[model samples]
Target chain A: MRVALFITCLADQFFAESGVHAVKLLRSLGVEVEFPARQTCCGQPAYNAGYWNEARSMAEHTLDVFQDAEYVVLPSGSCTTMLRAFYPELFRERSSKFKQAEDLAGRTFELAEFIVKVLGVTKLGDGLRGRKVAYHHGCHALRELGIKQEPLALLANAGAELVDWPASQECCGFGGLFSVKLPEVSLSMADQKISTLPRADYLTSALAGCLLHLSGRMQNHRVGLETTSPYGLSEVRPLASLLWQAVEGAA
Target chain B: MKASPNNYPEEAALVIREHPEVRASVTGATLNFDQNRRKAYSEIDTEAWRVWAEAVKNHLLTHLDGYLRQAEASLVANGVQVHWAEDAEAAQQILARLVRENQVRTVVKAKSMLSEELGVNPLLESLGARVFETDLGEYIIQLENEPPSHIVGPAIHKNLEEIRQVFHRHFGTALNETPEALAAVARKRLRDAFLRAEMGISGANFLAADTGTIALIENEGNIRLSTSTPRIHVALVGIEKLVPRFSDLAVFLSLTARAATGQRLGTFVSLIQGPRKPGEHDGPEQVHVILVDNGRTSVLADPEAWETLRCVRCGACLNACPVYRQTGGHAYGYVYSGPIGAVLAPGLLGLEAAKALPYASSLCGACFEACPVRIPIPKLLLAWRSRAVEQGMTPRFEAAAIRAYAFTMTHPLLYRLAARFIRYLPDQVLDNRVVPVVKAWTEGRAGLKPSPKSFRELWESGEAQ
Candidate 1:
């Protein structure tokens, strides 16, 4: 299946490494991956801030970009929710645009959900081992998408030891406009999550916005933990280098 | 004691800083309430019951006039005097007139949020009537000479030490008294006030239409005492509190009990049909029920916002809200607090007065999941936000920024150019705290560092493949 990467604006601008790792992980599993250059954003900021017209415009732009793709997968769970759940709400129910949006939403999946549920490839051949990790389940993914076990299943398959993190299901305070709009409550929420964060070598989640907020706060507080997405944790190599390792390991 | 709902950001910030110790108790209390509610819900099909509960509330809201008329007629038939008040001022006037006509010098009150909203205590006192709060939490707040912070747990924000201090200062009790001792003092004091007072006032949990019975749930028997001890028992009820049938009480009782305090049944669940019967020996002689609109009709007229009136006042949404959990009830600057407060206050007070309340949420949706009636709180918050924008209540800069963002996002080429342009901006200027408009975001967080290169730039340059 050809998977079009919906690298969220956050990933495209700041955390591009996670996107690079996502591509490698997919290609390693023998899946055709394509980058839709026109894809910019899922319009979460505008939509969430009550800017319906802006959100609709951005949503339409996204729909036009991924119109022909067989499967649209992205690393950000929050954006995926905006697409899969919120897009239909942006348009009238009986409108043709709403139908098309629903069709797109049906095929759209978060990276981990696409991997475990769709691709059916669980174990990644012992590439990740002996690592104590905590998966900070973003609120949108856990509450909105109902994705709890997929990421855990993937981590367990990769042979990573998952530690108990406090308030794992709570928001990391990266509520798009919320973080900036009400920074005190946002930081306090993030502080609450971090105070409960069990000591670990690595803390990861699928959404980069969370990782960005958490990693920034963790750095400020001098908490020692490598924060990244699941793809970034695999075997410590770029996709190109990982492809060579995959070939050599198969031999 | 003034509500700062208009300045939520500052008020929330102040609460976060000043009430540092409140965090643990609020967290512990809410978490406990949530867990107990979950367990209580496990005993039955909570989802199905919630759907039924929502339907019942929706039905009552749609046909409120009929149900309320039926309730008033049944109440009159049951020998309960019924009065109508169009708003808070009118309600206060009616209650004052009742007190004056009865020549009542002292009045005992049960936990009544309506009275609080009406600012009844001060009015009564000003009218030369001494009002004693009967509920332990209400009594404690009454002693403190402050507004009740929470609907159910009025004194939840106070620690034991503070309570001891308050009791010591006012009741001249020993400073080393335990909570049980404090409760005993309040109980003894209220018991005396309950007997001496000529009139009693209380809030109804639910007003049953068929029987004209007011169903009240409380752990402390203060409501019973307040309603029964005086010659005249007056119940202040929001018009929206009416349920169509006596049988509907079962579902609401279960939902409110489990949702409020995780109890399958309240310690005292009183369904008073009317005044004392001829055969009755101990109950009050004259029972009065006042149905106060107080902007409810305005709420009912709003197609989108009318759902705010479905609240059972169980305080479940307040306990489940993360913002309320953090700031407690006082920060809301209104009688109602938390997610429900955010929506309901605006509906009643209008967008301009309660504008900040709608923006106070993180939109986490915890309150929605925990609502027994499934009120869809997050959706209401969103709707309010849209209303705020449409009314042009947002700051000019904020409105302009959102429009600019929308413009940039729709045009991908512009979005890409902006994205590329943002990468080159220095970290110093990009710091959200120092930035004129984005300062709201960085007040509590360190600034973000933009990525060095756009993923599209890399993918197009053949490095991504």
Candidate 2:
């Protein structure tokens, strides 16, 4: 399938490594990814800040850039949700724009959602060496995309033992601009999130932004646990070896 | 008069920051409430729950006038007086008239956000009636001369230490900073008021319009005592609180208890159909059901905004909201706070009064997900923002900005040019500068640093692919 990769501004700038991992993982899954050269930000920052017009412009830019793609996938759940769920509402009054927005939303999917729901890839060609992993379900993915079980399903298939946290669905306090806007509140909420993690070998989530925020707090507090995106874990083993090993084990 | 709601966000942010202990207490309490609610709701099928909840609410709202008429007739038949108040002033007058007619000197109130919304306590106090708040949380906030932070947990913003101080200052007794001790003190203080008060005033959680029944759900037994011991029991509720039938109560009752406190049922779900029976030993002689409209009709008229009235006021959304969890309920600046409050307050009290509230959310959909009655709170909030702008209630600059945005978005060339310009803007130019109207965005936070290379540049260079 020809896919338009919506590398959210967060991934493009801060977590470029996760973007690389996503590309590698997608290519391994036999997906051809296209980068729309004209795409800028998803306009979530502007939309969330109540700058609806600025956000609308950004949304329009995104729509114009990737209007022809067969499938639009994003690494970030929140941004993908913005495109697929909220962008239509942004253009509610304009019939032509609304149609475009609807079309974009209909085709767009979050990473795990695209993999599980669209691509039907339960078993990614990935392997992990017996690490007890806990999943941090980002608020947007859990609530908007409803991709709660898909990532966990993939992680389990990758041979990682999943341990559930008490409040796994809670926000990691990286509410994009909210982290800086409400710093103390953000830190406190992040503190609560980090504290909720069970003592596991590694913590993983689909959204790199949430992981970065949680990891910053964990590092500050000296929690001694590593955090990675699901793709990062998936890309560690070569596709041939991982698939062959899985086949051999199954036989 | 309280400061305009427009000034609330800044003041509330400052208040929350200054009082770290109160914020911590609210955060702790809300976190548990949120988690327990999730666990409880997960036990039930979500789709079925939504259908059941929606059916009950829709049935009630559709037949609201009919139900109110039936309830009034039933109450009157049972010898309880029914009064209709067009607004808060009329409601206050009705209460004052009741007090004068009965020659009532004291009034005991169970936790009522409606009363707070109407500023009822001060009005009653000015009329020479000694008003006492009966619910533990309500009593603490009452003593402190503050608004209830959370809908269900009235004094959710108060910690034990603050409660102890309020108790010490009010009762002139040394108090300890513990939940049990504070509850004991409040219980002791409120018991006398309940026993001697001539009138009991409480908010109705749900008015069973089918049978003229007022359902009061309380964890504390104070509501029961307050309603029973008084000579006159007055239940004031918004017109929207009516549920069409007694059977409909089952759905709401189940959703409310689990959604509010994570209990299978509250310790007490008192269903008072009317005034006490003639042979009844311990019940009020007169029961009055006061239906207060107070801007609800205006909200009801707007179909998009009307779903806010379906709120059970369970505080589930407040607990679930990331912004509310961080800033606490005070930031919303109304009697109702959190997601429901953000949507409802603007419609009820004009958009200008609550212009900032619609922007208070992260639009995370947690509020919608947590809502028991399935109110699309985030959608309503965004709709309110649009309405606010259309009504010329938003700041002129913001309206112009959005208009300019709408214009730019229609033109692809302009949009691309703007993006390129944004990319070229210096980090210093974008950094740490407070923009007009949206200073709320950068009040405590550093501004976004401009990107050296736009996503377009990287994409064009084949780096992002």
Candidate 3:
């Protein structure tokens, strides 16, 4: 199947390697992936900040850019949620874009979702064989899209030891503008989620924003993060890169 | 006077920096409540019950005016005097009139958040009546003259040491008194107030329209004494509390008890129709039910936010919220706090008083999950946020920046230009020391930096191929 990769602005700008890995992973699995060069954002940051006019403008732009794609996939669950769930709501008052929004939503999928559900591929060559991994579920992916078991099933079957952090379902507090607006509270939220995390080889998540918030805070807490008893954890990676490594069995 | 929620940033910062104990207490208490609530929900067909409850509340709200009139007629026919309050001041005036008419020198009260909203205690005290808070948690905060921090667990923000200190100052109780000892002391002290008080006040958990019945669910039996022992009893109910039929109590009460405190049933569930009959000698001589509006009608008038009326004030959303756990209730500077408060404060208090509240959450969607009535709280929060923006309540700089970002996103050329321009900026300009937003990020995380190459550039380079 041919697909258009709606590379979210965050993944495109700050974490481009993850997007590259995502493209390779899709191609290796036999699905052709095309990068939509004009796609800027799914309007999440603006929408989240209550700038609907601006968000709608950006969303309208995104609609025009990906109107003809068979399927549009993004590496970030948050942006995918914006495209899939909120776009229709955003366009509901306008009948013209409303149908367009629904059609776009129908074709949009987060990367992991497309792999496990559409590709029907759970195990990936034991690439992560024996590695301990703790996957953080971004709030939008877990709650908005109901994506809980897909990532876990893929990782476990790929020979990774999944460490179940109790607050896996909890938010990492990178709520777009919420991270910068209430930095202290945002930092505190990240602390609460990871303070008791179990020992792991890696901490990964489906969304780049969550990784940025948690990794940023983890950098500050380097002294105290793994200081004592449990919770000996290491560097943070986006889930796409991790999935790609697992599938390709790349060291 | 309402606090400016614009001060939320300073208040939240102060709590995070100076009030570590408050954060600790709130987090512990809320986590405990959340664990029990999740466990309770897991034991039942929670999804089915939530859908049923949502349908019932929606039906009531959709037909609210009719049900409210029906409730008033049924209440008056049941020999209970009914009063309507259009706002807080009106509600306070009604309470003042009642207290003055009855010459109520003392009052024993159940824990009523609505009473707190209307400042019932201070108003009664001003009119020469001594009001006693009989709920142990409410009594603690009452002695300290502080607003309740949580709807259900009012003293959740205070640790035991602070409570002990408050007691030592007022009751000369030993500073080292255990929790059980302190409770016994409060019970012993409140028993006198219940006997001598001429008036009692409570908040209705649910008012049944068909039977004109007031249903109150509480783990403490103080509600029973407050309603029965006093000659005058008054129930201040928000208009949203009405349920259609008496049997509807089965679904609501169960959901309320389980969600609020994880109890199969509260220790006492009082269903009072009216004053005592000629054959009956135990109930109150006069029963008053005041249906207070206080911005509720405006909320009801709202097309998007009226769904918040479905809330039972079970406080599950507060317990499940990460931001509420971090900053505590005082940070919001309002009567309510947490996820529900984020929406309700903006709706009830207006955008100016509560503009910052809606932005306080991470929009994690946990509150939506924890809601028993299935209120889509995050969606409502976004609705309020958009309204706030329309009202020009948000910051000017942020507004301009977001609009510019949107402008860039909408124009492919501008986005590419801006993207390329930012990529070439020196590391010093991108460092936390240089930018305020980055400075905030560096407070708990690493500094922000752009990748060396954009995704479009990677695609152009044929790196993946």
Which fraction of the native contacts appears in each prediction? Answer: 0.50, 0.18, 0.81
Best by DockQ: 3
What does candidate 1's lDDT look like per residue over B58-148, in tens digits?
9999999999999999999999999999999998889989999999999999899999999899899999999998888888888888787
**Is model 1 an incorrect, acceptable, medium or high docking prediction?**
acceptable
DockQ of each: 0.47, 0.22, 0.73
TM-scores for chain B, listed for all candidates: 0.97, 0.92, 0.97
lDDT of 1 by residue, A92-190 (tens): 654999998999999999887888799996666554466566777767777777988887777766666778765777767777887777777776677
- Candidate 3 lDDT over B1-465, as tens digits, reads 244566787889889878989989999999999998988898899999999999999999999999999999999999999999999999999989999999899999999999989999889888988989999999999999888889999998999999999999998999999999999889998999999999999999999999999999998899999999999999999999999999999988988888988877788999999999789969999999999999998999999889999999999999999999998888888888889988998789887778888898889999999999999999988988888888888879889888888888888889899889987888766654557776777766766778888888889998866
Better of 2 and 3 by TM-score: 3
Candidate 3 lDDT by residue in tens digits, A1-251: 99999889888888999889899889989998897778898889888888899999999999999999999998988999999999999999899899999999999999889999989998766898888888999999999999888888888888889986888888877899899899878877888887857888888888899888777777664334432215544668888888988988855
- What is candidate 2's CA lDDT for residue B376? 87
True contacts kept of 1: 0.50
Considering chain A alone, report the TM-score of candidate 1 relative to the true chain A.
Answer: 0.87
lDDT of 3: 0.89
- What do the candidate models score in CA lDDT, each in turn? 0.81, 0.74, 0.89
What are the runs in model 1 whose C-alpha is more than 4 Å off? A221-251
| Residue-level lDDT for B169 in candidate 2 | 87
